[model samples]
Target: MNLQDLQWGLMMMVVGMGTVFALLALLMVVLMGIGRLDRKRPHLPPPPAHEAAPAEATPTVHIVADGLDEDQVAAITVAVMTHAEHRRRLAAPETRAHAPGSQLFASRWLAVGRGRESSPFPRERR
Candidate 1:
């Protein structure tokens, strides 16, 4: 390319890069301003203690298994209880409901297909 063409190319590159950087900087400032505005809003006090619901007692579970011994059954029960407790503690009050079963099944199937058993090449017909 000629010197004029090279100069034009360089000018275009600089202008394009500068525009992107300027937009990013502008976005950062706008986000910070929004955060500040949110922080400045008045805070509401939580409801008094008496209005809160009373804690419920844990329910008993009955399991019937033919082959398992007492120790094995106890271990399974403990594992289940620990898992339930962990889920209760970690779950968020405002979290969305679980996704549909079809979506979950499709995702799991895709995951299994992508696992170690997957082959890069297609199988030939017999």
Candidate 2:
């Protein structure tokens, strides 16, 4: 492309980006002003001074295993705990120990393979 055309493209890009930035700034300013105004005059009416607020009840869970023996209950608990542990292990595999004398990294090649393996991002197969 000609220099004049390239210059025009750059100018247009700058103008477009500047407009977006300015609009975002203006929106932030407007929101801040609204927040200040809201604090000055809150919409919610103040609670009545004469009436006492009702007490909140805390909910409780009651498990009823009508005919199950203690042994059966223990067995079920063990099964659940084992399954949970298996799932936890599968979700997060243990990282291997770093090589001797290279505490921060795992290799002499300067590769961060171990750190990448434990990262939240999924790895793609090479």
Candidate of highest lDDT: 1
User: What are the candidates' C-alpha RMSDs?
Assistant: 21.7, 20.4
**Residue by residue across 1-126, what tens digits does model 2's lDDT show?**
899999999999999999999999999999999988878654687776775445655554445487676677889999988987887676533323544455674454435665566685877899
TM-score for each model: 0.32, 0.32
> lDDT of all the models against the reference?
0.75, 0.75
TM-score of model number 2: 0.32
Tell how far residue 27 is off in model 2, in angstroms.
0.3
Q: Cα lDDT of model 2 overall?
A: 0.75
Which regions of candidate 2 fall more than 4 Å away from where they truly are? 40-126
| Candidate 1 lDDT tens digits, 1-126 | 799999999999999999999999999999999999888667678766665344654554554577676678999999988987777677633342554443444676676677636776767899
Clashes of each: 0, 0
